[model samples]
Target: MIFQNRSRCRENKSIFRAGNQVLQHTHEYTYLGLKLSSTGNFNLAVNELKAKAMRVFYMIKNTIRHEIPIQTWLKILQAIIEPIALYGSEIWGPLKTQDFSKWKKEAIETLHTQICKSILKVNRATPNNSCRAELGQHPLLINIQKRAVKFYQHLKRSDPSSYQAEALRCQEQNRPRSTLSQLMLKLQPDQHSTIWPNQIIQLQKLNDITYWKDATKSQKKMELYLNLKRDYKPAEYLSCVKEHKVRKTLTRYRLSAHCLAVERGRHRQRWQPRERDCVCVCVCVCVCVCVCVCVCVCVCERERERVSECPLSGCRERTAPAEVAAERERLCVCVCVCVCVCVCVCVCVCVCV
Candidate 1:
């Protein structure tokens, strides 16, 4: 008898139900170390895998041999990181969306920026491809693809009378290529779609007798893909380098902008008070913004994504070199009020007693 280890992350009885009724229902269950959600998406499993990989990577990095050779570290990664991160990858590998924007950025970011770069003793400035190449480690995405291809091959090679082969046949009838057609298309060396025509033909035959059996094709394809001459695609290479540059530039820009904003906010907070002040001299400056008859409503729209930025957008203080300041006398220690209104907006004025 086989025993499956139950995980603490197993799905629990439903706390909610439709039609304003509560029913004892379990939307998901854990079996064989996999978290299968009701939606049938690998999101939960993928998140778990990432958490496991990160924990294992850190554990090995610090607790174990402190100063291991790069090659040894690579071996350690393949042993621990791969098993954790790539478990059940064949099922959900191709299910990933092409758009990285919607992905859980933290999961991939930690893997790429921290684990992968630290493994190679490299920094974020290094190109992604260069980092993987220098480390002699396969890209996480590549390994997942290879697993998918292998699994497809296994399903094709299964017993003809088995349900697995029957399911493969059903999948073939529904689509010309496997579900991963788009993923494979992206991995194609050229922009042409017909490059993998033979693979497509075999997918059509998935329902029939498993005649096509070039099991090592995925490996060959990956090796060729990696070894392809990049000199021919100078523009693509430049674009990749430019992508890195853009990301770095954006990071620096955001940092400087954030620092300036924080400084301005601190200055504003220091000058301003929490309690409302009474302005005895309230100057109502209205610049006759299109006086309409019976309809005094005015519409003035400005496109600003971050309109709440500091120094107050409408009240930009500009003092030219030729401009002279008016002579002023210091007031005695007495209660006073100051109000200056401009551009149809009241400036918050305050005077200390």
Candidate 2:
């Protein structure tokens, strides 16, 4: 199949022969596990890779419980899944031009983030940057680009007489839209500069892998710390937690990914408040009522869902009964100005904070 931008040659029927037999012209072909199409579009190939990677990802996720350490999970992901997803990234990596490259990169990013969330036993709502920072993991795109850059470096350092080196030179000279050309454009090499620094060395210090990894992680963590400081929000609990480990746990709690959050969700799922007997029952039936300064009455019933408007003019906000079961419940009356507390009943506890 022809790999050109235009399909004018396709209109004319062409035939090829190999010895005594006729060679078939197929629209698509898979060679060395990488799919190639007549239109030269890499989207299909990327989709295939993502599908394979996801299958493996799920298998691993199901196989390994959260009992494993974060470092071990990271190792499994980087070793098993990344290789599958980024199999031919070195070849198609440069094709990721901004507006045209959303799905290609997003798929990999999603996989990486999901794995990270699973590793931390965090909720899906956690911010991607926070997860990456917590785990000290670089973005998957960086890894893919690094692979591409290293591949280029390898080709550059190959024997000049080798076909790969010859092809590299030829492509640089003739093919402006080629992978090498695109990578060079992205890199923005200086024309006036003669002496080229080793891309491999400049990209990362590989002589000591452990040191390099640690340094990279530290850099990432420092950047995250600076970002957090810039966007700081004072929390009461944070002031009390002086230990670094305790602060880390508090940060996770703030992000809604801590064990408390998980347990809260589980509790909500298990004990659903009846809609009819909802404490903030705006309409009719009295489920449970507590005679306090700020009275919260809930009439919770099975499979009932409706919005409960506050009868009191003081309480402008209206809450759903289903939400009262799933989330927090607020009082319709003016009980307290600033302080909010949780109330545990005889059967079910309506936790509001």
Candidate 3:
């Protein structure tokens, strides 16, 4: 009985161990499957995060590369972080959700730390001197600094509360407003005068002269003429004018000249070659010549082949003589026609003369 009880207890323990092992294996498999299913999403998230970080880094590098102003760098940083903060609540979801709050807090903290560190890094990286001193110097930074100073000054004047405190604090700390302004004030103007003494004397003399009275009289006469011109309507006034004999003479001369030009242009246009007709004639001539040449070649080739293959020797000889005679008769007819056309042209020319 004691052996059986011990055996039973051992069996129960062994079963429990096996069951636990199976459960462990099942849990591991499930976890692994879940991870595999979400792997693509996880990788995408990581890639996006890395890309954002790279973009921010590159932006900072470029800003520094151009020797952009510290204010500009600050503005860039602010712009980057502002949206993140503004959308944090929506992005993180409700605070009641454990996953959201925890993730949001962690992300915000990490970003905040990164931005603060980046700001310090950028400030340290910027050059103390002018851009010309270094290769690949940033002009954007210089412009940003100038704009920032202007903005600060404007704010100081327009709204003391917006800028006075900051300026006073900066002054107390003995900070320089800008390097350019300091350098400009330190620079001395060239001693040489741009204008000569004689020119100055001439300008003074001209200034002393009173030409206004004569100028005023001429201006009044001009104004009166313009008023008379404006008051006269072209169609109505021309009809009303009684002494238009001189105008009529001028009008007749202009009309005759215009009519002569119009007639000359009309004659010229009538004689000019029509482009479309010329193109059509050229195309027709080319097509006719090509067709005739092809027909002549084909006929000559067939005649030669027929002569070569002729079983009867007298047949080629008889046909050749007849063909030659016919060709001679055709040429004679063409020559006679050309001579007749020349004779007719000469007779017509003699009659006209």
Best by lDDT: 2
Query: Which of candidates 2 and 3 is the stronger one according to TM-score?
Result: 2
Span of ten consecutive residues with least summed lDDT in model 3: 128-137
lDDT of 2 by residue, 1-353 (tens): 65657555665367778898988777778989988887887777887898898899789788865454455667788899899989898887677642212532476677787777766556776665556655666556666667776787789889999999999998888767576667655554663543333563344323223333344445433443444432212333444555646665766664545566443564464653676346443321132223342242332322122333423324436444465534443433233421233233322343431
The C-alpha TM-scores of every prediction are 0.44, 0.55, 0.18
Task: Give candidate 1's whole-model lDDT.
Answer: 0.49
Ranking by lDDT: 2, 1, 3
Q: Please give, for residues 227-313, the per-residue lDDT of candidate 3 as tens digits.
A: 333221122322343444543343323222123444235435455356765665556555555655665565566556655655554
Using TM-score as the measure, what is the rank order of every candidate, best first?
2, 1, 3
lDDT (tens digit, per residue) of candidate 1 on 216-258: 2233322332344222122233234335445334333322222
TM-score of 1: 0.44
